[model samples]
Target: MKVKPLKDNILVKMIENEETSPNGIILTGAARGESNLAEVIETPEIFGEDQEILLRGETVMVTPHCGTEVKVDGETYRMVSYHDILAVFEK
Candidate 1:
């Protein structure tokens, strides 16, 4: 929340797979895997961290659905390459 990513650097908040469906259908957490798509909220500070350059807006989707996972502020998230991004969705 306090940290801001730089150019070409996307801060993604990985979404967790649903344990229960909207129709009252329930599924065990182990039954479903983690989500690959992540929401890009902010871009890091340019000239810092030393990276290529990505935008601040939009989501950076990942591929193979098996990337890297990160935990921030007691929350679980993920970080994947921009090239691995599949698509962006509106939250």
Candidate 2:
């Protein structure tokens, strides 16, 4: 990826929604309805000094329509506001 998100913006790659669980439960993308869990690709250039709420390569639940979708080298990515990030998950 050659693009950088400025200020408090974060660049992320969408993670595929689970299709099935180990317990034989079927999980569909529609189950999420209006949110997407994505992996952060790049952290914002500015972190206000020692802020650690977000980091590169972290999986986080983000608002579905918070940012603009960008295409880079045939891959799709979203640049979202740092405040729009709802939750972080262990990779």
Candidate 3:
């Protein structure tokens, strides 16, 4: 399924964080707290030269409690504004 965000809105999927303790104990994101990190699923097209381009599959950090949650085909997604995005991770 394809989903396109409107205007400066971006579609993202939450990325879960997993950590392993020194004793080999695994800890999930839920065990600690909800993660603010997300992967860009769909980015709004830029029509102006001043707008920055965000590519799909890029990991991004968003502001806490920002964006609207959405569900598509049993999959969860978040629609966040461009201003709410903090940083993008480089490969």
Candidate 4:
């Protein structure tokens, strides 16, 4: 099926996480008790440093915890209301 995001909704392609560091640093998945940072690979033209995310990776970070999740080209993303969106970054 074909789907299109509504106003303020964006489609993003998720980048797979790296299993090892470029310097050959081996990193293994942590246990449940271990805290890991969420890895998000975004395009420079989409979102930049110091700018609030209005829409990204097809998902919108609305109110820090509220937003709709979406998918594009078999990749997961998100959607958000315009008010929930902060800004759209483009280079």
Candidate 5:
């Protein structure tokens, strides 16, 4: 099952960070740092407006509560708009 986002929408797969801190303190789900970071999955061939700086396979930090979550082929993913993408991370 492949996904292709429309307009400025982007498909992202959440990247969960470790549950423990550097100091060895185990963090609970509520205590975990907010991880808006995710890997870009797919985007439209051409954007409706300005060309988006994001591309498939890139990791990005998105705005919290900016996207809709979905389950595809038993895998969880989020569909976020271009404006919701706050920052792109280098591999």
Candidate 6:
């Protein structure tokens, strides 16, 4: 099932990074640290007739450990407020 955020909320998928150890072992994001980086999956379509500042597919930096967790089709997503979005990465 597909999920859409309401109001100023945004749906995002966390971007995980993997690190290679000196012994050739791999470390996941969880081992290193929780990533604040996420990719925009969906944003509220309308907000007072003004276009949303954030667009889908844009990478964003959000406040750590914020937002509600959601699960859809076996994938995890975060529903965060627009205010929680610190910055957006330009393509």
RMSD of every prediction: 4.8, 2.9, 2.2, 8.3, 1.4, 2.7
Residue 33 in candidate 6, Cα distance off native in Å: 0.4
Give the per-residue lDDT of model 1 (tens digit) for 12-69: 7775678787786887766666666566655555544544455555655567565456
lDDT of 3: 0.87
- Candidate 5 ranges beyond 4 A from true positions: none
Highest TM-score scorer: 5
- Compared with the true structure, all predictions reach lDDT values of 0.59, 0.81, 0.87, 0.41, 0.86, 0.86
TM-scores, in order shown? 0.57, 0.74, 0.83, 0.36, 0.89, 0.82
Model 2 global lDDT (CA atoms, 0 to 1): 0.81
The TM-score of predicted model 5 comes to: 0.89
Task: Kindly report which residue pairs in candidate 3 clash with one another.
Answer: none
23: Cα error in model 2, Å: 8.1
Better of 1 and 4 by TM-score: 1
| Cα lDDT tens digits for candidate 6, 1-91 | 8787888899999987548667788887567688899999998767655535688899999999999999999999999988898999989
Measured with C-alpha atoms, the lDDT of residue 80 in candidate 3 is 93
Over the stretch 29-76, how does candidate 3's per-residue lDDT look in tens digits?
567567799999998766356668889899999998889999999999
* TM-score, structure 4 vs. true: 0.36
- lDDT of residue 35 for candidate 3: 79
- Candidate 1's error at 23, in angstroms? 5.5
TM-score preference between candidates 3 and 6, better one = 3
Question: Taking the tens digit of each residue's C-alpha lDDT, what string does model 2 give over 29-66?
Answer: 67635448899998866677645657788889987677
Put down candidate 4 lDDT per residue, 3-89, tens digits, no spaces. 555544433332334667678776677422222112222323333355444333343223454345565566665443445544333
Ranking by lDDT: 3, 6, 5, 2, 1, 4
